[model samples]
Target: MTAHVQQLHRVNNLCAGLEWVADCPNRLARKALLQLIGEEVGFVLEGVICASEQKIPGGRPPA
Candidate 1:
């Protein structure tokens, strides 16, 4: 779990650097940022399900 969070943080930092590159067009940067945001949201949701299943008895986590 710690490793996953660390990887996500690294990805976010890389995305930030890509967003600041002068050669990348505004539209392209926006698209990349949006994709990264989607990935981050998915990660958060997965973490939530994992935590919830551990806390609740007989709770089946989402696939």
Candidate 2:
């Protein structure tokens, strides 16, 4: 699989893990984990966006 697909899968797994951690008894740790997950997902999305933006309108990406 491509790196983009792998990153998406990783983000999906992180989301699922976040859902499981939502029930944790420790509020601080839970919040920290959630924040980390959010940041990770954000970084992945940013990368995707940057990659897309790198493509030009000539039916090909810049060299």
Per-prediction RMSD in angstroms?
A: 4.7, 3.7
Q: Give the TM-score of candidate 2.
A: 0.78
Give TM per candidate.
0.52, 0.78
- Residue-wise C-alpha lDDT for candidate 2, range 1-63, written one tens digit per residue: 287778888888988998788998999999998898899999997776566657645444533
Q: Lowest-scoring 10 consecutive residues by lDDT in candidate 1? A: 15-24
Span of ten consecutive residues with least summed lDDT in model 2: 54-63
At residue 51, what lDDT does model 2 achieve? 67
lDDT of 1 by residue, 1-63 (tens): 565566667656765765465455687776777777667767766775676676688887556
TM-score of decoy 1: 0.52
Q: For this target, which candidate reaches the highest lDDT against the unseen true structure?
A: 2
